[model samples]
Target: MGNQTSVNRALTLINEGILSGVDSITLEQLAEKLGITSRYLRELFKTYVGASPKQYALYQQLMFAKQLLHQTTMPITEVAFAAGFNSVRRFNEAFAQELKLTPSAIRKQHAAGSMKVQANSINLKLSYRPPFNWAHMRAFYQLRAVDEMEWLGDNSYGRTITLGKVRGYFTAVHNSEQSCFDINIVFTDTDGLLQLKRIVSHIRRLLDLDADLIEVEARLSLLGNALPKINTGVRIPGVWSTFEAGCRAILGQQVSVEQAVKLLKLLTAHYGERVTVGGQEVLFFPSAEAISKAELTELKMPGLRKSALRALAVFVSECPDSDVEQWLKIKGIGPWTVNYVRLRGLSAPDCLLADDLVVKNQVLANISSDPQESELIDIIHAKDKAAIKSYYLEKSQLIGQAISPWGSYLTFQLWSQQ
Candidate 1:
């Protein structure tokens, strides 16, 4: 068998690149990022994705262009450039050659159909595999909604975003009946169309719209009584950026969720930018530069956590491309913090947060409550922090092997049980 692990990691990097607006990424660039030769990368793609890297990139661009044409009022020229084409002539040629239709023909067909166009906003449908428990997803965000920067309605969630010179807000309304989210995005910048692909990719990650629930559920089903009755559509609800997620994770240490959100609100109000879009006011999360320089006296958390926050901000500011593993060098940041960021911030599929308090409690409650395992519970709750952590780590790895690569989902499943 081929190296499934390498293929999975490579695919994740590609998706992350696209989500970060690297639409014109070349095979050599991807290979360099993967630390592999182009020949092997091409073979991996050909075997797994059924296409060469070039073909796959082209397909993504065309699919994005077609969605824009079918769903939004963007002009064909803007659509071409937005989808990473240098010129409309080339876009038209490629579209016709690959899809057997011209850009104008597609636009005409879209106009002929039932199209709903809203002024100053782009509306699109994001699909997901069925059995999506949107209520659980909505409740998760609703509980931790930050003021001004995020808002949650009964059936929808909206948040302000700052994406490299583009400031905007998007509202994703869950349509359970249709198995998708009807998202409406409004941007302050006129050049926002250029960032549409990245924006859509972020929304997909944020809502976890691309997960195959059937496969995930089936794999997670083997854990038996260890996990609560598997919630049908538990997904990793993501943050806007890794930096934002890191900040949230640092602030959340040794605190309740409500207290963590209060700290976030205070930090946002102190340093985050405020803007009005479509006559509605919202706040963007603070930038690394802003937090790196601040004294953080406004936050009432422990001084060590504040230091950790600034250290993270400085690390992100200096080495924007550093891996999450590098964050451990900072004092007060540990495995649980890094794993939390990986699970929710990057949506990594294999992270098992064994050190998490809720996870530990849930696992102990289920396993320790058994009369035969009572002595094991006493050993776990013993005074030695290091030993306790090691025990949980070992236990989580055992469970993680059972679920294999879906440990991130397992983490959420345990959290959802609380």
Candidate 2:
């Protein structure tokens, strides 16, 4: 990598470290991890991200502390330590500086409107821009919901989650009245407040909490019948870990969604970590390192696909970014899987599955349709499948560029039509 690219990569890594609550790591240790001098790392962040890494880390921790105070009834001291503060005094000073309010007062203000909760559970709320299409989001996840670890029912989505070695489960129900999700979390311990922070962050991404729907709609609306109008909030559903999502994309290649989900379930059953809570069994998807070290011959998959899965796991173990060129180096991976992983896993806003079968079909139809649809079929049959896909991919690139950053949402809308 070029020096500037390396600096950008390090900055991205540092941002993730901060968000993941790496408050305990010393500056020297972090600099060593990034293979840069501490002084240079400080300069890069000051130039790009507008704050020192330490200041950013402190702000993230304090934000989590603020959320805990507003949502949970945990004691102030426990909240302090859980937010990575060494003492309640330090937490108080930081909290006062950031929000201009004491933790106790914040809790008191939230208590009046808080939901009734059991002793061991935490109740919180997740917000998104309005006009959300709950049905579309639920259907997308429900189609591939794993057997034991995840499920979508009625209007709510629930799943078992694992952070490091800590295991917990949470459910989110749409509260149309409040324009938010009423999230209920039941974990093994009340002291797992740090785990709660990680869980909340992942949940926000999973449901695309940070998306600006109004802006997306405005940009997309300019395309003018280029994409069907979605009256509600449509978002690209994200996974907790990019590794798992990449593996899924590999498994999904050239297979029906049902078949791919079936293989994933079997893979989980065979190699995933097993845990039980309240008589219900759940499995954490196997990690990249674990899969990279495992024997792939035991699985009933094609040899090329097995190789692809293992190669992907190994690549991810070494480098965590969603590098499509690196991914295409795998044996069975292609543009479709690479872009699918980018759109869903890394939360890349501009990605489009241009090579997707349904997307190609839709783009071809949009380009030319005839009376009785017979001419379209004849034209489709006249060309080789590769030629047709290449033709549409070129056209889709133009359409995708026109839409710019909301291409992922447009991709989802096209898929929903099928």
Candidate 3:
């Protein structure tokens, strides 16, 4: 752990390179990103991560596929390919060997429970990382809480999100007594369950559950006297699907929070496929393909903006294997849309959507304004400003050592505060 920065960067690189999309990298390339010889990177990974770089990459690839299989309706073969497995036969073999269940069986196990499990618990399971600050998350949502459509779940802490079109309700509880988090979301019987796993995955991402907080806290301990009131382990709220998050971002453009929520409601209600479950109305964010097939021209969108939104959806539809980079290129889409999707949809742990008007104004008001870009740029500079800040803090007692592991979490917490 001597080269904390390099090791930490390497870890993020490894995970991102594997999970960022439908591609996986070789050990040699991973070594290059860490600025180390392949042998050295292999040794470093084995020592710190308990697995060689290649093994870790394989684990990530396979596990991601496993999650998708258990959570989605996607064919096992497709999940295998998406997770970078070379062949469905190999994926089935490994999954059966490693997890004691065939990939197909895992999907069957869930599908079998379609009737026995309560409506709320059927589609997903509540996931969490250790040391989650549940109270803080509930409080954060409460402050910016929407009025009618959402309800903060009773006595216990949780937020109720009433989506458009699809009928569903999700309630999250930090089971302090159990030291585990609990989530229950029941959607009207639809194809949405196939996508629910993706939603839960993004939620885990936004909350930064993947963060290694101990390393981050160690870094923040150093900046001691000069730092602003920095908090550790703060999590960002994430949205489930990229398109769903993107649509919300579009609705939020240049409007007040209340107005944006209204627009969100209007858009979902108008374009979404409405459903009723447990006697409540819920909407599912429409897919690009679905939107492309539907008639949105008569909806209340502004003339060109309507087409712009449709174009964005169409762009994503055309590229079924869409990622953030592609979403940013569509007309009327900008840095804000991508970052919003990254934060809410993709659940990127360290992304800060300072590109938004509110966030930009907050940045300028809190820090110096060299330029509008400077405000956004500051967060990305110096191998991650939050990383730098955390490293400086953790290394306060050290002279020139690398504070390797905590930078990602540092970035996550800082962006959450902003």
**Among these predicted structures, which one has the highest TM-score?**
1
Range of the 10 consecutive residues with the lowest summed lDDT in candidate 3: 399-408
- The clash count for each model shown is 0, 1, 13
What are the lDDT figures for the candidates, one per model? 0.82, 0.74, 0.56
In candidate 3, how many Å is residue 157 off? Answer: 8.2
Q: How close is candidate 1 to the true structure, as a TM-score?
A: 0.91
Instruction: Estimate, for each residue in 213-281, the C-alpha lDDT of model 3 and write its tens digit.
Output: 565566656633322346644665555457777877776777666676666666655666545655665
Give the local distance difference test score of model 1: 0.82
lDDT of each residue in 253-274, candidate 2, tens digit only: 7889988988888777777877
Tell me which residue pairs clash in candidate 1: none
Instruction: TM-score each candidate.
Output: 0.91, 0.82, 0.57
lDDT for each residue of candidate 1 in 48-108, tens digit (9 for 90 to 100):
8898777776777888889888876678887887777778888999898899999888888
- Model 3 gets an lDDT of 0.56
List candidate 1 segments past 4 Å from native.
1-23, 114-120, 369-391
Rate residue 249 of model 2 by lDDT: 89
Query: How would you order the candidates by TM-score, starting with the best?
Result: 1, 2, 3
